[model samples]
Target: MSVNIMLYKITLVVYIAATILFLIDVLLRRTSLGNYARGTLLIGLLVHTATLATRYAEVGQTPVANLHEALSFFAWMLIGSYLLIDLRYRLDSLGVMVCPLAVIMLLAGGVIFYEVPHQNPMLDSWWFPVHVTLAFAGYAVFTLAFLVGIMYLLQERMLKTKSFSGLYYRLPSLDILDIINYRCLSFGFPLMTMAIITGAVWANQAWGGYWRWDPKETSALVTWFLYAALLHGRLNVGWRGRRAAIVAIIGFIFLIFSLFGVNLMLSDEHSFDAFKSLR
Candidate 1:
């Protein structure tokens, strides 16, 4: 636990430094500093992983069964996705957006460290880990796609308006953003499907039903349907650019509402009591 705390402190510090460096790099147009920011981000990711591993070993289970663990996992997923995309593409500008988000998520996770000793009874099954992990992984990818879509729209708008501001210059081309958005969604969609299937199976085992209209479950279904529509529109309608980008943005908004808003605003078996305590 002491080691985990130290790792958490290190992650928080590195994430803050990375965010500052990325922001400065963007403002000053320093690509070299952006490389330094990426290295800082890598350090943060390593420390965060070590902390989670330690927690898992201490707990004798995957730590994600509790609110604090889930929130930590969410932060890790964000950084992990960013690292993968950054390695694959020259998306340093994206780090300027994502690094701050990672910092916020990690800090929030740290602040909400109230210990809920017992796991939720509903989440006691073997598939729980697979379901939750895949769901969060899919969410992470969608989050990246959402940010890229935003950049695409902004760049396209700037082009149409003939405004060549610093942001316009800093962002990638709309075409490139569109391609990145599609690639992220393509990778995320299959993982989301697997999550849904595993979740349904877990539901059947725990609740004697496969599909309860619980708020969380319903919201997830709606988000899934929205993304499925986006995918279909892209495939059947040959929607490959700005239009597809818009759909991705909408899908991500719905995903956030489903993941956070629904759990806070409504009641359901999947609601894990983090709502009342803000943990």
Candidate 2:
């Protein structure tokens, strides 16, 4: 009914259309359609950005206080990151993998329309937006890394078997994918680290403690360590290709648990229902 909601729906439809175009391009080996897919994706990104801007205008805060908002913001970050990568690397084929992910996140957001009350004082803190934005941005890039890792494995398998299917020809080279994976890790790791540090500072400011060892916090730490080890292995032990890909995949799994699983399954300061009084 509202303009923001209408824009959100339009963005979702555009994303779905873009995803279909990308899928067809990949499956039919029609590389010429790549431009059309990218154009559609850009349209969706623009619409989605407008939707977020409208929501922020209404709320006067980061539009991520509830699950729906969080998911939508995460999806936006994912698509934005993918577009940057596509621009830099000319990897339009990756859109086939990424567009569907954005669609799913948007769909999940659409499923839950109950607006969370904005009375929580945490929304007033300057650190809230910074922390959540950086954290989800990190998650978004890590997700891209995960998808690239999967593609790397599939491409590697095809090469090993010497089977040159359409997929084999369509996907980028393992070297290119590996480079993307490492670059994503390099970008995401620091964001995650800063998120944790900001989170701790916010927590201490709000709850009078720097470390509560909440389930969400612990899981976040685990995720950080997983990526840290991967980075260490890459820089020191020369982990590359399959080893690096596997680590990235596994790290993303842990990240999913940290982001959604902990919030859903455990009661913590971070849980949606567990808001604390600023007093």
Candidate 3:
């Protein structure tokens, strides 16, 4: 096997180990288990970073042109985001959601759609990395918000029914989850805005027009508007709790469809095949 593949497999193992530890910690509320999980996830992120770096060395450009590369990088960024959030919130419970998603992303990227690196001139632009980095970072933050949204809803329900479960015990209070949801929206909005702006610039350079109204573009625009409205509601009207959580979940679902579905299932200018057709 190649060095990249070797490292990816190792990282996947580490991520799985971390996820299991996190799950155990969630069930037991043991600080030691949470610490081990966090440490293991840190090691996995380092190894995954090496994998991306090595892929870049092998391929002459950023390693985000294909599903495997993009998903792996997405998982890497999610782990990084989770770590940063952990530094402040001590959100050990968040790991139960984040780590499993990371593991699934790594598995889907590495196993289902592994592709050999091929130089694509379309991805040669400096804008490619900049746009993708911002886009994925924004998505990572939104995913966190989405998970926190779920937690908020669960906590709310448990409180209303007065039937608290073990998972309920592990979850943060509704107030904290709502705060996290708003904070994530606050951070993700700007990154997503810049992603769209840089994307327009890149699209203008690559395509003949600034807007193609392609499926990806349309979905991105809609997703942008969705979050914009959510933020607007929070800032202007003071929307929070259940309403905010629901919107977050809806927005992320649309975002994922834009990211994966449009690329693989639907034809769009963003797809590799479409890129080749343009050339």
**Best by lDDT, which number?**
2
Steric clash pairs (candidate 3): none
Please give the lDDT score for candidate 3.
0.88
- Runs of candidate 2 exceeding 4 Å displacement: 114-116, 273-279
Q: Worst lDDT window (10 residues) for model 1?
A: 114-123
Model 2 is weakest, by summed lDDT over 10 consecutive residues, at 270-279
- Cα-based lDDT for every prediction: 0.84, 0.90, 0.88
Report RMSD (Å) for each prediction in the order shown: 1.7, 2.9, 2.4
Q: What would the per-residue lDDT of candidate 2 be over residues 214-239, giving only the tens digit for each residue?
A: 89999999999999999999999999
Our tally of clashes for model 2 stands at: 0
Candidate with the larger lDDT of 1 and 3: 3
| Regions of model 1 farther than 4 Å from truth | 114-116, 277-279
Q: Between prediction 1 and prediction 2, which has the larger lDDT?
A: 2
Clashing pairs in 1: none
Instruction: For candidate 1, write residues 1-279 as lDDT tens digits.
Output: 577777878888999999999988888987779889999999989999998888876766667765567778888998899899889786888998988897887788778764644655666678888898999999999999999988988889899999888898899878789878888889889989899999999888997898988888888888899889888888788887788888899999988888778777876666645665554
